[model samples]
Target: MPTPGFPPGTLDSEGDPIWLTELASDDPNHTLHVVQGLEPAEALEALGAKPRLFRPCVLPEVKPDEWTSLPRAALALDSGDSAALLAGRIGAWTFVYDDAGHTLPHDDTILLSADGRTAASSLYTINADASLSYAVNGEQLAHLNVDDLDLDEELPGLPAELRAAFEAAGVFEIEDEDLEPGEADYAICMRVVCALAGLTGTLDDLRRIPLTVTPFG
Candidate 1:
């Protein structure tokens, strides 16, 4: 019973994305943040997106090719002071992707925005350091390092049930035995965080859909 748009065999045999037994992804190193109660434009702006780099020419009838089209993923702004990002909404969640910025949108200015929206930022670095952090109503919640899933005490304002859920999901059982660990754990972290944020649609949906591309350099 894999979620309909999700690739077949992605979920565990039990059909749970949170406890995925195997996950093979080509694009493993990226930053994705899903914010609650924000539209794509608002989320990007709050996350420090600069003004849209509108295409210079207006072709009224011709379909814009990839060269002229808004990029589905980060392009030139992967380094320096800014990052290339695309933000889009799926249900109540707005998902933002940063090509190389592992800490994108986790900035307090965005997560702790005066507008009061919250977000869950998930990062999977090339070094296999995976983490998931939540921002709620201007407060930074526990930032869980997937490799070290240890919570000695209850995190303030974090739902007790969510903590229990992580425990029950065996997220604490992750080990560093293989050549590249945390890949599966990264998927688990993303699914769990997105689920908690009430984000609908598959990860592929976010990657493929038409989103607002913002150049932040």
Candidate 2:
């Protein structure tokens, strides 16, 4: 069975998620920290004194007639200094094992170019059926394999309703253009995934984690 901590496949027990309060430490590479659960208000309170950032971590649950197979939660973290932080925000959750020179939980993995120019076509599948495919670009990317719908051969702009849905589901943002394709793909996929999960909204309502720093005093 999947554990209740972190994500389904990442931990063995329900421990408070770790928060990095300092950038430098006695052992920067090996340092460990713990964060106890806080209510949304309390979390905001903690952020008042420190440069803390928040991301939603979803608890896993089974859903009936759902197209996606995996259960997931959002993970909010500091987005300023570390590649790991940026990667987490973009939906790539696996950790790199330097010793192994590889990443874990290899399923549905997508790799992005450093400058965000290029992205792999199938880093992750949507709707569980893998019927649709996607390619990323600056304004909007292609959503292919849409066998379920047949409006026209031409790529249609995201409908107002779908756009609204994306926003309402906490997946939309104006800063998306500045993000790399991989990061953009992560955001787009999350919005679509939430839609498939029966959540409502347009992309505009999607909440994004702000880039910030934290200091321990």
Say which candidate scores most in TM-score. Answer: 1
| TM-score per model over all chains | 0.61, 0.20
Taking the tens digit of each residue's C-alpha lDDT, what string does model 2 give over 1-217? 2111123221112111112101111112211111122222232233232225433333223322222111111221232222121111223211110111112111111222122322222112223222222222222244433234332322246544334433333322234245332222223333333332232222121123222222222
Model 2 misplaced regions, further than 4 Å:
1-156, 170-187, 196-217
- Candidate 2 TM-score to native: 0.20
Worst 10 contiguous positions by lDDT, candidate 1: 54-63
Q: What local distance difference test score does each model get?
A: 0.50, 0.24
Candidate 2 least-lDDT 10 residues: 93-102
Tens digits of per-residue lDDT for model 1, 33-126: 7776877777666766655652222112221332222232234322233445656666766776564553454563246334576667767666
**Deviating ranges (above 4 Å) for candidate 1:** 1-27, 54-82, 102-105, 108-113, 151-157, 160-184, 203-210
